[model samples]
Target: MTDKAKKKREPIFSPEDRSNLRWLWLGYLKKRAPWLGAVLLMILIQGLVYQQFLSMTESGLRVIFESGEVGQLVLVCLGVFFLFAVRGLMSYLVPLVTVRLSNEAIFEMRRDLIGHLMSLDLAYFERTKSGEIIHRLVTQTQQLGVFFGLATAGAVRDAVTVVIVSGYLIWKNPILFTTAIVVLPFIIWVMNFVSDRVKQAQGQAERALADYMNGIEETVNGMRTVKIASQEQVEAGRLMKGTGAIRDLMKRVQTTQALVMPSIDLSSAFVYVLVIGGGGYMVLSPDFDVDGAGIITFLLGMVMVFDPARLLAQYFGALQSNLVLLDRVRSLYDEQPSINDAPDAVEDFDTGGDIVLDDVTFSYSEDQPLFEGLDMTFRGGQVSAIVGATGSGKTTILSLLSRLYDVKGGQITIGGQPIETLKVGSLRGAFSVVAQDIVIFNNSIWENIRYVNPEATEEDVWRAAEDAEIADLIRRRGDAPVGPKGAQLSGGQKQRIAIARAFLRDAPILLLDEATSALDQATEERIKAALGRLTKGKTTIVVAHRLSSVADADRIFVLEAGQLVEQGRHDELLETAGLYSQLYQAQKKGYDGR
Candidate 1:
């Protein structure tokens, strides 16, 4: 995020994000608590045993150096081996269980986030970038895994280890223990400084990474246009710039995290000097309780306590560094789609009815309203065409008819009932859309057609294909892959598949937005013929640019800047010499093959 974006963006718990952050994070963590508990317990037991092993070393040193008890030394050394074995096994089990817990959290977190993303309305997608969404869903959600395995769980268990070992050291020699822990406050201060820097750097790095991903996506999606324009070098440079930015930010994160270990080691070194210098002086003064053997034990115990303290410091740093992930993931999960089903919205509705836009008003921007007091009706069981120049709200009408963007004012209805009152599913289910810009999934022909209606039979698919004039192509291709966005097929062939989907859907209303545009005359006529059979007896709305295509419509509605300027059959519209006549005459030369 830019510095301005970071500033404008308050904390993750903004009013728009209603859920409590702690509760949201704990909700996923609670489900995997058993695995968490199992790992923590294993580490706790191992860590305690490690303390015993250090005590055994102290006893063995006393036996050899002071008392000279050879038999006692043998027994003490054997005890150390078994204790170390338990410690090693525990070290192995901790990671194994932690991984399982992390993955379990990752799976559930991703599942819930994806379902939420899908439930968002079209406007959310329009406003949010695809790469940013992918970052939230894929990259940020994975933070749950690391949050448990390496950060929170490790810090908690290691803190426990530090406490147990520190108590043992203080019990043995309070003077030396006090001297050994004098640097602890400094360690803590260093940790806090490092954690804040790491968190800031990592957050910036992740934002940069999202932009890098979006750059690659744009370059790939528009490769054909890039090649045509000879902008390959430009796109490559842009992508490299994104990658370079991400690299620099990530390096900043690593540099901050690197401060943790070295600061810990330096603090440990200070404690070591204090313990060694103070213990030797106390022994010489004849005021200490024990001899050199006891002093050796004090050093060994300090080793036990300080090492875990070091580990705790590292885990604490990691925990702080990734705290921002909770905000990132929660930001997405809290986005509530405004356009969900109303409390009284009805479904199981009748399919056959006139689509009426009554006193409708809408706009993509408030200052530039597209439609106001717009009123039109397409009678059931008839074909209606909408024609307008570019920017004259041709596609906007189709979007309004389908309720893709709800009108700012007034009501759109089917069978005299407002569409907002009907369930969104039932309302959208009434219309089948085939726009000039069609979407073809990367799948086989059989799968592609069935995707529109999964319950469609193979026989039903074949019949629909034949109706849309795509049967011959499917029979030849034999369900070969369409590659990305149907790159394997021609424009006309892809349009035919979309037509097949509509045919298979066989809804009561049809929406064709420039469906017959950007095609050779031969291909246009063939698709027009298929469209002719497809629209029979249905309330079909067609938005066309070429006047020649809608000349045979039962009604042609001419719109200018979101207002209906004229409405009549083709001969009647041409005779009116209004916007319809002007647009028709502009394209008359090509219409007449001149």
Candidate 2:
């Protein structure tokens, strides 16, 4: 190996990765040390028993072939048979314990990974692709699980067997022992060569697979749009391209792995030839001081060492390939949630009074600030609305109020308390949000409704459903699958389901974000009625692009390019003939034209 390659083998992790390894060792491996130790002990016993069995064979062969006798043949046969049984048991237990230990650790790691992902702020997920996250969550861990099996089975058991057999070879005949292992250096070099390519190829293959999965998720979720636009062929071509990329990358990975066996075989064949030729020459020469049985035993020991040594080589190569997966997983684990409770954050803080954005400055991107020194408020115990053009920062205002994303500057106060000072859960628990993009899980309506409030009784769910005018949906669908994102339901139906969830939440504050924007006039009328009841006697804040929806709002705040350009009751703003009036008039003209 080159010096660079040798150096590359020393550090599995960079300096940044050292912190993450502490978690793997301290959290997972250390916890499994007892079981791990027991497995190693079992492997050790099995290796010693195997060596003893080989010695017994040498004795039996000497009596039959050279001495022309059959002393203790029956005893010898029974003893060898008993050793085989013990060896068989060890084989079963070794893999069983090793796999179980790995499986449990992986199960816990998965649980922790999920919990950590949930704790991250919305911005992290917004910037990240769902496909990449899923790949790391599911696929990376699975690869590690398989690698652990090889690390234990090949590294430990095979290693112990090789050591014991090699020692016996050295004691019985040093010349034969040295000749038997002449191929070791070549095998090591071959594995190192394959390993360098394996890491690079596997990394690319993993990325390609993630992209392919992401494409599947996107196209499958947007299937309706594909069909509506008559772009099925285009989507097919896109996916075909993705699959082709994955296929080529995998071919590289598989091709590299495939070379391992043949390379080892060639070196092994050389060892077999040298050992056989050398053993025969020794048997004929009295100067060597060895019997026919000794020569036979040396040849058999050579046979025994090759398989384990071959496995060890393959294990190292596979370990290199899987290191990327391990790094990907560690990268995720190392991510700290950008939004978390402060050191002195208060959880028991009360919620009431106006929610004021005190000169708040924020942005989704650094170059273009969405809300700069912007200020607004929704009165306590009253329904309010914010209206604007598409890029007017309407939805962003709602996100800030709910603390889904923190403001870059200034402070937001609820009930006269700075929101950042309160625990995130306590702050968010004060409001129930129904967003433009509603999420419906792939489960029955009953579970979907009840999940938000696990303690809420069945009757409570049905009542909330009735209040949202969706009781009939639950009654009819009852336990039937909703499919992903509620594909089985229409837009109006999904809107109603979100409203039902809000009603069940019954938080002190209500946030209605374009709830009725996507519905038809008839459905809008129904949803408006539901919203009317939901907002009663609560601190409600509504954001919408449709001026008609917010026309009757108790107070209207009009935004223009992330600035508060207008605010008042609807008729009051219209009479002023400002930006709000222009928006309302334009919308009115469009509706009239339609």
Candidate 3:
């Protein structure tokens, strides 16, 4: 790769990376220390028992050949059986403990990841794909648990077994054992080479999988649009591209893993051959000191050593493959939320004071400014309306008030206190927003309304539903599921449900973003009355494209190209013959033409 390409690619974690992932692993270990300690103890006992079994087998053979004592052979057999029983129990307990530890750690980590994602600013969601986030939260997290289980628990057990078995071999025949283990360094070198490939392939595979998931998510979410546009083939082809990329990357990863395992096995077999040949020469030589039984023990130890060596090799390969996933997950955890509470944030918001937007300068991007030093105020317990053409910073103003995005310059205050000084939850809790785009979950209408006020009584929910003019429709559905994204409901019905939610909240402040735009004329008029009833004696800000809707508002603010061009009552603004008048006249002419 060129230097530019290398710089563009995100660097995967290496042993030398020394990132907070190390601390994350340490924290998990500390949290599950009891389970970890038990697993380690069990592994140690299992290793010791395995070594004892091998020794007892050798002793039994020597007793039969040299001592000719059947009774002693029986005792040796019984000792081996006892060791096998203990090893079997330890093996079961170790895995049991390790699984428990893994589950607990995965649970906590997932909870923390979800909570962090929830606390993140809305801007993050706007830029990120839901499918990608879901993959990290679900699939990668599970893989991380498996990696932890193998890397820490499985690796330690296999390592202990190899150490014990190798030590026994050296004690019996140092020269032969040393000669046999000489092939291990070559195996390590081969594994290291394969590991680098695995790491690179694994990262590509994860990205491909994430892309595949994104395609699936989009296709599923936009099925209606795809069908209406007759673009099934196009979407399928796009999805196939994602799947093909994933397939190729996975093949590379699997090929690397497949080659590594056999290479390690081949090297181990070669070492066994060397041990057998060398030990045979020593036993047959006149000057040799070791006997047949000792040679047999050395050979047995070599066989035992190979099992763990192969296991460790496999573990290492899996560890390399999963490290890429671990890095992705860790990077997500390290992300800092752009919006957070101030150090001295107020615990509560005084909703009685007017909301003042003073010289508020803001922009979504540096080149395209949305609002520049804009000033406005919504008096306490009064309904104010913002009217403008599309992309004139109407809804953007509401977003600013809610602190979904903070101002780039100047300040916004409520009740004579700067909004940044108020706790995010408390500030948001002061207002109930009914936005243009309503989000309805696959839940019953009652639950959806009660989501904003979980403590609300049944009567209170019904009251709010009636006030929002959705009670009759919900009564017909009863507790029926709304289907995914409220597919079972009509657009106007979904809007009414959202309004019902706002009514259930009954907060001191209200924000309506084209709240009744989806309704028919008759339904809109009825909802307008309900809204008037709902907004009585509350600070309300409404963003409407329909100029007639705000004719009765206490004050109307007209925006043109992100700047406030007119501010007054509806008739007063029309008499001024400004941007507001032009928009009102156009809308009135359109209505009259209809």
TM-scores, all models, native as reference: 0.93, 0.95, 0.95
> Which 10 successive residues of model 1 have the least lDDT summed?
8-17
Query: Where in model 1 is the C-alpha error above 4 Å?
Result: 1-21, 67-71, 591-594
lDDT of 3 by residue, 470-566 (tens): 8988888889999999988888999999999988999999999999899899999988888998899899999998889889999999888998889
lDDT by residue (tens digit), candidate 1, 1-594: 787657532332344233434555577777666766787788778768867876887788878888898898889978998888888888777877777777877788788888898888788889888998898788777775777665666677677778777777777888788777778788867876777677678778878888888889889999999999999999989999998898898888778878888988888888888878888787787666667777877777777677778787777666654566766877785688877678899996656777788899999989999999999998888899999888989898888777778889988888888888888888888889888888888988777887889998889999989887789888888868999998888888888788889999999899988886757788777767778889998888999988888888899999988889999999998888888988888899666787
The residue pairs that clash in candidate 2, if any, are: none
lDDT of 1 at 466: 86
TM-score for candidate 1, please give it. 0.93
Is candidate 1 or 2 superior in lDDT? 2
What lDDT score belongs to each candidate, Candidate 1 first? 0.81, 0.85, 0.86
- Over 4 Å off, model 2: 1-22
Better of 2 and 3 by lDDT: 3
The true-versus-predicted C-alpha distance at residue 311 of model 2, in Å, is 1.3
Expressed as tens digits, the lDDT of each residue in 1-594 for candidate 2 is 887657655343445446655767787889888988889898998888779888998988876877666656767788899998998998888888888888888998899899999998898898888999999999889878767764756588888999998898899999987887777778767777788788788889888888899999999999999999999999999999999998998898889888888988888888888877898888888788887888888878877888887788778777776777877887886677878889999987556588899999999989999888888888988889998888999899888887889899999998889988999898888989888898899998878777678899888998899888889888898899899998998888888888889999999899999887668898788767778889988998998888899888889999889999889999999999999899889989999999
Total colliding residue pairs, candidate 2: 0
